[model samples]
Target chain A: MKRTDVTARLLPKLVKASASAEQFAPSNIALCKYWGKRDAELNLPINASLSVSLDYLGTHTRLIPIEGQVDEVWLNGQQLQPGARFSRKVSAFIDLFRRDQTLCFKVETRNNIPTAAGLASSASGFAALTLALNDALALDLPPEALSILARMGSGSACRSLFEGFVEWRMGQREDGLDSHGIPLDASWPGFCIGLVEVDAAEKAVDSRSGMQRTVETAHLYQSWPLQAAADMSKLQQAIQERDFSLLGQTAEQNALSMHATMIASWPPLLYWQPDSVAAMQKVWQLRAQGLELYFTMDAGPNLKLLFQRQDRDVVLQHFPNLETVEPFGSE
Target chain B: MKRTDVTARLLPKLVKASASAEQFAPSNIALCKYWGKRDAELNLPINASLSVSLDYLGTHTRLIPIEGQVDEVWLNGQQLQPGARFSRKVSAFIDLFRRDQTLCFKVETRNNIPTAAGLASSASGFAALTLALNDALALDLPPEALSILARMGSGSACRSLFEGFVEWRMGQREDGLDSHGIPLDASWPGFCIGLVEVDAAEKAVDSRSGMQRTVETAHLYQSWPLQAAADMSKLQQAIQERDFSLLGQTAEQNALSMHATMIASWPPLLYWQPDSVAAMQKVWQLRAQGLELYFTMDAGPNLKLLFQRQDRDVVLQHFPNLETVEPFGSE
Candidate 1:
């Protein structure tokens, strides 16, 4: 048995030694694109793409051990299903590395960010999970391996394995050995993201359903890989140079391109709500009035405002209806 | 004066022959792609796309001379302002062509397809006008030139000029001379389209508002040109090859892509009804269950199903909740 496993039986002694693991998993926004997969088993992207991890919004997860239980997981006070779409791959990870031992993982998850608003929920969730699992098991998987595992959960989650901007390198080799997430820089500073949460009450069509339908029916699906690969290269270079206009433009474009692939998929579908449009119109009207706000969207209605920290007040006036508008910065 | 023009002025002499010139304009579906100006002055596309001119779905517009009136215009039976969006565009065309004539354009417009449903109303309206103007003036611009005139009214409208499968070539020359609609195939016989009008309420955001906002704010607006161009090429190839799987997929993707661009646009928005998602989910589930239905969507909640005429029964079973459904074929 591993030393960590034995600590559970000898709980009082383990408490005296006092070990806890906490990690910050920031949200990610795709710049280049990674949509569609060449190898489902390996979770390989049809193309590479770049993404930026934000400083302000994400999940802060801490893992501690309890005395009696064999194995348990408490996510934000809710005992999560190891089978959850977000945490399924993590369960697979735990099963693989800690094969012989059992321990209760007391996870106190604090998600400061909104869930299912299409703002990289998986990225933060998985990033925090990576740190928690890494410390809890005392198993060391290189960042690349961790990313590959994360990719199995959600393709964008892989980007969260690192800080600042990163790229999920769509490896060329067919065997899928080189495919992994690599950090570009932790250098982005003075940037803050303001969110406009359009109160879109409509149910979102699961992306998984859309993606599957698209692959089966969308004639344009094959073209996405090449376009996504090209977009990734363009965005990587732009991010490396800290080109805000280019970064903002590329990220927005990539997101739309990804959504376009969905639109062009067979049975042509959408995830947009009426409120989403109203919010977008309000934003554009504000910009036309010269507020200088740049918008980015994921699959859902809420928008992320990428602007200089100082320009927030001017931008906030435009989105008076947002439920919560807060500052986001990276350490 | 030509015999027709002289006869038109003498209302009693103008029999049904001149009245035949006023066949109600049918609505058209933009097939290839229409976006950003190759020449904003001329309203040319960055790339060519294909659109089908519908027979059943359209608007009924008529012009009648009023005695002692130099000029008068009515839209949808309302004495709308000459500056109303549709009227203004129509007026501009008339002014450019018939500068010397004072004609009353009495338009009694009625939509067979649901209003504010994403099916292209203007595509049909302008298409009808192109034909109507030609008949009214005896200024027979060939189909290609008529398309250029229609292009000025709305980018997507130009595609409706051709019957069956048509492609709008986004000509490369800077003078904007080459962008015009051309038939991809002389016949679109095999395909039958069924429209499922879900929740027949007026759309909150019209395409004009949705598209304009998309252009101004959606970060995805920048990448639209490149993606749309590629889609046009692929769609043309798929149509020419007579591959239903390919055609269905590309069309579906294109429709979704347009919506994505809408969502990515500022004030993040959707024109979808709550029932739109439900209707689509039902279709997807039906398709998954081995139904032969392949569907596409415009901006509205209405769904366009493209399949052989024989597949109507299978498709109809899935849409029990729609407001109305009607099918059309080239025959």
Candidate 2:
């Protein structure tokens, strides 16, 4: 099914623009990673995933209705050229909302995440863009509808729509209407995430292409759906019970399993740098010494450490430059 | 079936020792790795494996009958204490030969593979020791029988009995008589191996325990037997056809797949250090620029680069300190 058909079915036929709209969406780190796709066109996942939203480190997007024929995209005070990949992607996403009507938008987005952290901004970017579009057009769609829309921009963006613990259910439908993020009620106040920046360089292979290549060439990827399902259940139980050990272990293993598939792929996709291994070894060494620290990695080299508030000082002692974030703390 | 039972069925009922005997055996690198074991006692593999023997980089052993209550073991000019793990293992292997007889021998062995290369000496060590014992006792066993005996000491040691390409067939039987290395008739003269040592430190987990842990804990290991089988066929075909690309691609992919299973295991086995990753990235970058260089890693941080002789200059230029070995060259 086409993305336009899904959007058309959910959105109103006629909508008037509010003067302007602004929205904020937090970035999310998947505890159970979303690796492969069941439907690439609609960004439908092959397996369910769970994540924790970063409280204050995210993206802020402001949308203004414009009279020009083309959408103008600006990021961090710099306007993107129309032919730039980032600008083109934003324009395509905006096109889905302004079908048939001659509507153009001026999009301004700023990410609060530190550049050295090497975190992907697409998750929060798409999520915030979707929310701003909904508000500017006076669509007033529910959270599920907004999440499904954001997912069309980027798969992980669906999880970024919610706060605290969120689960993206891989729905059993061709249209992908049921697949959206749901926020879990449980929250641990002292839960911490330590960002260890290994490298700030651009990735050789983006996650979208990397996921496709792994699904196509990695024979061991056959077992990944089952792994994701098991990890998702474990993560949910850990969150509900506040079991830090279970949470940390499951998250670390889940990330490693995802990376295993990538490494086993043909032409091998390795996103780790030398410093990435050093950081991981440091975490493992500290854990062996009874510090209770575990780490998760995405498609990039940086590591996101999972620990509690009690062990924060010790973790920082080893990783002196670690950027600490309390996911549940008041900003 | 017990290892002793297998040995008893193969060896002669009575044998007299020679005054002294010496032997030499080259080390072998697995193109298709021998990973999981079906029978730990007899060292029977779960799947077939293939390897190429290094021409001169190997082990030399001298065995002399001595009048003593216990055997004395010396390695590289240093006498090993009886209680040391290496000494105990060597003594246990010797005990298998003198079942009912009270025969003692002083054994001295040396490995020519440079210490910094971080290659596992067990394959060459056991193969040389087995050959020397056969000559010392006047057993005069066939190559298959010798390969089978060497396997009981270390699984990959079976392949070290041959000079060029070898295949260790995973025979189906309770006695494991048919499971032995056979030298292939094909030869590729230009084949080269470059050793890139990342770290020479002791591994946190030995291959024996690591393999056991992976088989028990890694769900993805269920797919390994199938992968090995497929890679073994491809490698044999590559050798016969002398297809450099096919040989390099299959070997590299097979090694990565094995590491993938370890990474998917609980408590994740990662042998690649920071420098290992850096070396791998350099290889990939060079390959992208039209240099046909590929790499394979065993259960360690070091990488063994596979290329033809023509590309040696370019490979050496990139890795200045690389230890180059022409596996098929006359030493």
Top candidate on TM-score is 2
CA lDDT of every candidate? 0.61, 0.90
Docking class of 1: incorrect
Model 1 per-residue lDDT tens digits across residues A235-322: 7666568676666665665665566656655455555555554555565566668655666666666777666656666766666544
Clashing pairs in 2: none
lDDT per residue (tens digit) for residues B1-331 in model 2: 8888998998987777655889999988899999999999999999899999998999999999999788899999999998888888888898788887888889999999987686789999999999999999999899999999999999999999999999999999889999999999987888999998777344558899889988887767777888888899889889989989999999999899999989988898898888888898888989989999999999889899999998898999998888888888833
Worst 10 residues of 2 chain A by lDDT: A197-206
Q: What is the interface RMSD of each candidate, in Å?
A: 5.8, 1.0
Give the C-alpha miss distance for residue A298 in model 2, angstroms. 0.6
Q: What's the TM-score of every candidate structure?
A: 0.61, 0.97
